[model samples]
Target: MHPSKVELRVLGTSVTLQEHIRKRAEQDLGIKLRFVVQDGGSVQRDGVMHPDRYELYDQWFHSIDCLWPTHALQPIELSRIRRWDEVNALPRTGRLSKAQPAGGAGCVPADRLFVQADGTLARKPSERISMLPLTHNADSFVYLPDSMPASLVEGEESWAWLLAPELAGRVALQADAAIGAIDAALAVEASGLMRFRDIGNLEIEEIDGLIGTLIEFKRRGHFAGFWSSFAEAAQLMIANKVVIQSIWSPATVELERAGLKFRLARPREGYRAWFGGIGISRLAHGRVLDAAYEYLNWWLEGWAGATMARQGFYISNPKQSRAQMSDAEWAYWYDGARASAELPGPTSKHLVPVGQVRDGGGYVARMSRIAVWDSVMDEHNYLVRRWTEFMRS
Candidate 1:
């Protein structure tokens, strides 16, 4: 190791840029890790516009389409990742099982993994990759059962409920268009408000139709709020300001700590999924570049993965994190078994009580049911233009 700390600036969203994670990285890697945390949209826009501002970029695979085209991020040499071969098949291939149906629609990680010689990303194997796959999860909306119009039987909760009359004026949506739009589309389709040829990549006509309907609802005061970060989303729930909303899993954990009973819907339509990882800034070099790789390798080395796993996210190298977790934690978080003891969450606090099972079952079972992924559509600019209109309206 270097005699002095090598500082690496990381530009990223709230998910991986968490304070605990930042401190841990600084401690483990013996480097100065600065996390410039922002909302997902801000991270993408900033990374694309000013990649040189940071040494490392951390976000979701969906961001590759935007960052890669601009050459904002450089390709990852997979061999540099110490546990490259240990990464699961979901990111290298589309499915966890050979018999599992294709990982449905949007920027599936496999489709963006390999970096081609033509300075492009592809599905085919190569020495270089677009991003080092890290954490991922199949996400569904959560609701306070008490606030829902009628009691929901677990596994019966539908995305349609987010738009139901009973929750009107008490519903929240994610403020960012790219991801929130997917949640909106899923709810709309589940409610029979409209249908689209491809929900992941909404065509302009579909965007208009979807936005038009949401705008009408907005006019009617259907939404309680639109949140930009996990803290904001958690506040909407913790204060009981909104009963149903799109949320990050960690926000749900916060709700639990606050003693707010909520049901993380195993939506009949299936969950909206996302995968997050790291990319070296295009301008990185020398010590900073080597430090970036160190941070990346550290992420796959189990501690960081274990940290994320505590919050309900699965790491690319599960085996690595599995070794770091307690037997009870592995069973509770991965095997779909009831907690053998009270479980600690992302933080050290033991927020998870014994006997509670994860909302969705095992890793394979939950991942297998993904309906779609957060995406960057072909008409992303147009979608942003229209999405801005929706936000303003």
Candidate 2:
């Protein structure tokens, strides 16, 4: 496994560490590609503490909060990426549409996109970046509307529903501290339980107050389970009878395959957004580095982006990916119009039946409504330590 072949090890979460992308990259780049896929927390930990183990890191832009501070990733030269400029304004300029304010909740991508001459990440664009922006999406909780309480109605959803006393013993949340806590904070605020000074970056007391409420809820048997992956999130609903829980897009599509009735809530408050991309390890150089750049550039040329779009993830460079998708697909997935015909996303077989519009709406509408972006708070270590009490209780 050494020397004879040009092998590139890419580390990331399940969101982008997909099998189809791996096979396609190997075929196109002519390099031995291996994706070390793990949960988001494990991926970030290994990437920061063990940079030499992988050549490229593929994960969300929020990762810069941890990886950049530790000097785990080298700057991705803007000149090296062929389609860098085509990336959408949201990640580059910090706003999806000019109508809204620049940047969204949490660690906004634009604020940390550039690597300044002084070697710090700031909003001012430079010749290099901490990560090559790739795929992204706006996420909200998913629930089975049919099984919900009469008081819980579709299109009138609220994050607070996750905390409703009626759903006790049947709710679930992701186990990750960063994401789980954000959703919990949203619920805590929405339920009139407590208000956060800053939901994205919780202070010490806020973390205590938030997690304390969650601990109480746990003791009351409000949460049915905690899921680590999309499949598990989907299964919790199917087998465990979890009627409502935080869920990813892939899991939503999987339920469509099973013919279940559900809705990815457009929470009245807004959405939790994230941007994912590739970054070279600081330890990478020579042939491995060259291959890493090749892989990064390949992600921008549209095929990989289009493939991910099928699963409801948006490519940073939307136009490039648009070319690879069919007209119906663009209409349904991007335009937010009713599907002219049957279509598929993030799966081999067709998933969307005729006349189904994408949940939330078009790209701009959904992205612009970000209530928070997935982020690591300033009190990250302490948050993790305290968050465990809620999970374990």
Candidate 3:
């Protein structure tokens, strides 16, 4: 590897976000970035057991709980981050200037976020944190508005639609267990098939019950297929004529670009929220470590944030990102107002047409009504094994 190069292993869900920053960082910081994109599960395994292989991990907050116990990540010194104070102030101040909800399975559990004196992990805040919060957003499924039946179209959107008998054989899901299971659990509960005690942190029994239902659905040919990446998810909808499935924001943009019209469903039950950030590998040191710090700072420097904002993702420091964005972009993405003009996506492709309004409304309205946060449940090991079985079934 070149001395000026930094290797980063990031989840596929964030490929566009990283690409938005890669060139800028190389030009401004003089550091070459080599990105290894894979599913979150693979990233988690590599982050925990082979921390030395990558300089940084860009993944969901759940990865912190999975990796910190093994000391796979280094404590991020807040003082080194350019926007450290702002990052720390987000949860308190709320991204939209209101008090955000406290305590949900979707959030990083306080008990597992801090670094201890002996190089272990703790829950309490200190000078160092587990990771530098970056891009985050609420996620939900999407469907073709025209493909939906009149009854469904007239009714409120619900997660139960994923499992509705009317839509069987046209529905799909994410292949990754961590997020897929949660979406499936929501569908199951909404369908009145079963309910979880805590959807975010399912127990062993809940895991089994949910996977069992998924297996039954699969066996019954209730799904068109499963997707491992955003590109794959988009393809599933296009190639298979899938009317509905779990979708990422970028994928939705890609679908629209391909001439497929889709509606991002705002389920009455609430949105599945996720928070992602960058974590330094425990083995990163010296120049590589310095580069890592610079790279992290670059994300908060406003350019990357503005880019992600185009795709409906919220930056940790909206003020900085807003400064980099046009008023139209800010109003459309953050304020959820009708687009004043054609709006571009992360790739700078015009996706939102003039007068188009965001699906879930403003940042405050969406974030405040989160149904669940993407989480690594306590029964994660069991959940994965069962989820694998269902995928194979």
Candidate 4:
């Protein structure tokens, strides 16, 4: 490794900072970049336990809640970020401000985003923050159009379909406890298997009830498999091993690349939303620290955001991203207009055909209607234990 190279540990689900953007950042910033990609769990664990090993960590916002308490991250000076004002304004004008369950119960938690005098995190405004906001999107399952019964093809899609008996033995689920539990809870409620008081932060009893139902389904061979990574999820679809399952945007793009047909659902029960960002490790100093900040700014630059938008992601600053996109690309992606020409995926491969419209319409319309946020629940430890049992069953 080059002595000046900055080590960045990012989520596998991150499509924005892939090779092209990294290469561009390297050329433009005059810094050597090294990427260590992993699933969310490994990223979180390594980031918290071994901060000295990586200069930068890119992951979901919920990770701030998990990592901040441990002092694993450094306070990012707002003045240093090129588009700090635009980043701050995102939650104020965008989906983060919207209440969850869409008028049912619970408010979006108050912003716990600030830097403290001790170089730790705090909730109030300050000269610094714990993380730099990056790419975010809502998630839902996908299913093969041909796999559904004729009667269900034109009918409304629901999260309940994950647990529908007709799809039993042909369904898959995500293997992550936090995300998988939320998806299962939604399915349980939507399928009338059970209901939770608050699905976002499930109580002990609620977790037990949901996992119990899932275990029973698992025992009956209802699931084709469980996937731990986006690539695994895409492969399952490609192999036709599962008819319906939780899906990430990039996975759907991969499925399309394989010439497989899948529809990302606009579920009637609403979508699971997630927010992600990048944070510098507390261990970074001097030149390495400078490189980390440079990488953060480069992510907010328009080109990477445009790449992410190609595969159904929204950046904190859309203005910058929009500038890098063509008019037709902007219309087909952000404006919900039907594609006038065949559109490309994140890797610039043809995916969306002419006249095809994006599912869930535009960003504002889709984000405003979130059912739950991907979260580490209150009984997270217990949820993980029970979830492990369910998976084993």
Give TM per candidate: 0.97, 0.97, 0.93, 0.92
Give the per-residue Cα lDDT of candidate 3 at 160: 95
Looking at model 1, residue 92 earns an lDDT score of 85
- Kindly list the per-residue Cα lDDT of model 3 for residues 242-263, writing each as its tens digit: 9999988878777877888788
Off-target runs (Cα >4 Å) in candidate 1 are 1-3, 151-155
**What are the clashing pairs of model 3?**
106-373
Per-residue C-alpha lDDT of model 1 across residues 322-390, encoded as one tens digit per residue: 889999999998999999999998886687899988887899988998899889998888888888898
**Number of clashing residue pairs, candidate 1:** 0
Structure candidate 1, residue pairs in collision:
none
**What Cα-based lDDT does every candidate model obtain?**
0.88, 0.87, 0.80, 0.78
After superposing candidate 3, which stretches have Cα over 4 Å from the reference?
1-20, 88-100, 107-112, 116-123
How well does candidate 1 score on lDDT at residue 204? Answer: 88
Off by over 4 Å in 4: 1-17, 92-110, 116-124
Candidate with top lDDT is: 1
Prediction 2 global C-alpha lDDT: 0.87
* Total backbone collisions for each predicted model: 0, 3, 1, 0
Stretches of model 2 off by over 4 angstroms after superposition: 1-4
True lDDT of residue 282, candidate 4: 87
Q: Which of candidates 3 and 4 is the stronger one according to lDDT?
A: 3
Model 3 gets an lDDT of 0.80
